[model samples]
Target: MIAERLSLQLPHTKVDPRILSALVCGSALALLALKWTRQRRLQQKLEEARRKREHALMEMRTMSLQFKEQNPSVQLEAILSLPLTELVEKLREGSLSPESVLYTYMGKALEVTHEVNCLTDFLPECVAQLQDLKKQKQRGPLYSVPISIKEHYDYKGHNSSCGLAYFLGTLAQEDSVVVQVLKKQGAIPFVKTNVPQSMFNFDCSNPIFGQTLNPHNHKKTPGGSSGGEGALIGGGGAILGFGSDIAGSIRVPSSFCGICGIKPTEGRLSLCGISSPVYGIKSVHPAIGPMARDVDSLALCMKALLCDHMFHLDPTVPPIPFRDEVYCSTEPLRIGYYDTDGFTLLPPCMKRAVQETKKLLEKAGHTLIPFNPLRMEYVVGELFLKGLFPEGASALLEKFEGDLIDPNLKPQLSVYKLPQLLKRILAFFLRPVVPRIAGELKALCGIGSAKNLWKQHAAAEVYCQEFIAEWKKLRLDVVLCPVMGPAFNLGYLGKLVASGTYTVLYNILNFPAGVVPVTNVTEKDEEELRHYKGHYNDHWDKLIKKAAAGGVGLPVGVQCVALPWQEELCLRFMKEVETLTREKSRSTIGPRIEAL
Candidate 1:
């Protein structure tokens, strides 16, 4: 009976400790195996993403080759060889029809887009617009003129993605104020160009569209976030393009791609209806302007956009029409120039451009005064960044969650991830030791509160006052400086902000600035770069080294800046520079070419 009871009880009893442990281990293994299978599936998905990117790149290259084959005459020099004023004059006098000009540009643009990846949105309606202009027998300054817009600006029935994938199908319900103005002036908007994700980085790359290459040299980047517009204009596909600059967006690409661009003062042109990730934060100002192959075209576009109706559309703008009197006069003016910012040493090509420009201005009887920037390091490093993203740019970056961040913007996001409290603690601790650098650090760490935001605004006002004071003391009308180092090779702009030293200062001051191509790369310029000694000992040094290493034969450009609301004066300076450069080239080539 005991044996029988033991057998029955054993059947009902729980397993021994080792057996129970074995069963639990088996179940856990099964779960882990299932998880491993899921993880493998995820890995496959990632591989598929990479394959898609590669396929897109290949398709783009193939299309570029086809474009080149179809239009062999569309060379970089060919695009920049003629002035836009002359082109427009010919079109007006019946030498070129609207359709002919539009087709030429469209063909070229189609070709360039394949190679450079410049277009994010293109409209077939442009063809119809040109056709209507041809039919109506009407013409204007930009009539039938093909213009490309950066993706940030709104156009009715188009996606103003601003290069963000999340906003992919979100089409605009109506045109931005500027877009309507451009249309009313008879400009045909053909293409919308690519930008950096969120328009935050100097390099242009986003999940929505890839990268744009410098037209002069494909190995180098066309600078951003207006990089696509810059490349399109530079490549001769479009006569004019529109770009916005809060920090070096217009100027950097203009410099890198060997084109002319203008950044007007804040509120000069209407910003109403423009789309951006960081909307509603107006602490730092972004002005819209024109980019083109020549300065005259830039001036013309500016005049057309700033007509009377535009000011009425946006009440915030001052009722300042294009001041033709300031631009048309040929009076000698006081110009200020500085070779280096006392922080990062400029590349040698840039130094030569400035030096050569000074010689030309002096010969023309203009007063060339040497002016050092008023504490640029303190301003850009400290104040500008602090005020730019007051609420810490979290919203802008969060939109890209799970997407691969551009290598150039990775460091920026890391800085953004730290707690605001820690950043403030660091700022307080370091304020007494190195106030300017500390301020810069605090800004980078996004430590500003409501009180801090107000303080930064006040600081900006003081800086602006100081800048005006210095200008008054020197009695200067315009300032000249290198836009950046020799155009950085494509794909390597992730390392430094030194290139922005020239343009960002103007942006911070809300001054009008323009870029004029002065010279192309030469053997001598390349040799000088081989032995460059940069002033700043940081990532700037590394950036300089990379730019110098293989950046031979690229174009170099310089900035010409005028006081706030002085767009007309800025164009005048640009014209002077252009004239001087052409005359010098002619003089040098005269005897050699004649003998040949």
Candidate 2:
């Protein structure tokens, strides 16, 4: 009876199992097709958004050009010349709102970026923050102030490429410590500036973002790795910005662009969450600092950054409070002045700036004493190359593995590919005969290995101590020297990259330094180069020739340095120089303008 029932049911289903299987397969295929169609549509939307964003940027660029053309006077004036401080005060008093200030800066930023490629990421959040501040009535010292950051610093949801294309699309999970501090202080970060690829080269160029040119002269570099910040601030786009310096990264750009930048002592500022190609190696000091048009703005930013809460964000920094007495004092200080580093001499323009600055300081009743750096050639030449690649520069160069390196950096990076064993053997053999040979050996193969790394570190420590001891012996409060030879032409940097010895030496010693403009290039200064005879060193002579030949109308700058954690002193010296220069200019120009 059961078999009969089964047979009847089976026969009724002469709708075959094959037919049922086909129906199931058809359903599965339909679902997959629907999913594929949805995915395609989503991808199309993403592509469309990307295109629209690009189009918007293009439109912004065009508008920037039109705006600049319509308003010519805006290009020559610094952002500090604007009513930013007044606007902030008014915003606090409810007489003005954050939206007005944000709009003004954003428009100005767009205009500046068109003339100079200063921004890497433009901030849309700034507008939103302005609206929020207006609604909440939040009051902070930096409220409604527009700030720009270096690309190396992290900003949540933005790329901290540090000028590498490989890291492009790698969004930061959170803001860097400095960014958080700035945001909490009510400063609106309106843009992220460009940097040298890997933040190594003094000349700012990378495969991802081209090069940042000096606003004073577009053909020449603005200097790097804080070059974009320097260019932006110098162009009057940013009132204040963040910059990091290891080896003249901040100071060089500041000098090249005719602005003020402070390179604080290592660990004085928080470095947490700041990304870079080379991270753990610390033979040379790298610190984050402020770049601005004036020293006071730098002081304002520095005071904001050195608040007690910063120590909580990064335990590595000492809990030293910002000393108001150090910056605000009017007491006379002893300053050391040197026209040359003994290895590479300064050009006539730089030499004249140094001379003029020394005289200005003297007139102000500050003691100016001649100070010769002890063994500056041996120290800077050896330690700079040694500390540059303590763990072997191979890893640093690897970041640019498939990318095109800037022409100016090729000479330096070329040394990274040499065989390690050969370099060691050469160093061992040449140690007795030639001192610089060891540096050359390390440069050729890149210095690595536990023994070599420790040896380099030890040497760096010894040098730092000895340098400080000498400074103590000299009883000096500050040292003034040329930042580099006369401002180099665009492509001429490759020939004189070694001129950085004067600046990089301070980096090795971890001293705080500031660059202040002394004077612009003059015909008299240019003519002095023709009769000059360099130190007779082949490399030095060649560099001098390249610098002097046809580099007539560039700006010249000088550096003021103080001991570790003495950023306040360094800035004080800078302000002194600025004041002296202004006084001299007024005395010189008063009669001419009055006669006109």
> Best candidate per lDDT, number?
1
On the 0 to 100 scale, the lDDT of residue 198 in model 1 is 81
TM-score per candidate, chains pooled:
0.85, 0.84
| lDDT of model number 2 | 0.76
Each candidate: RMSD: 6.8, 11.0
Candidate 2 root-mean-square deviation in Å: 11.0
- Candidate 2: the clashing residue pairs are none
Candidate 1 RMSD computed on C-alpha atoms after optimal superposition onto the true structure: 6.8
**What is candidate 1's lDDT per residue for 165-227, written digit by digit as tens?**
556567789989988878777888877888987888788877556777778777778888899
lDDT of each: 0.77, 0.76
Superposed by TM-score, candidate 2 places the C-alpha of residue 344 at a distance from the truth, in angstroms, of 1.5
Give me the displacement of residue 144 in model 2, in angstroms.
1.2
The superposed Cα distance between candidate 1 and the true structure at residue 549, in angstroms, equals 2.7
lDDT tens per residue, model 2, 306-401 = 876688888889988778799888999999989887776767788789998998899889998898877765565457766677656776877875
Local distance difference test, candidate 1: 0.77
> In model 2, what lDDT does residue 514 have?
88
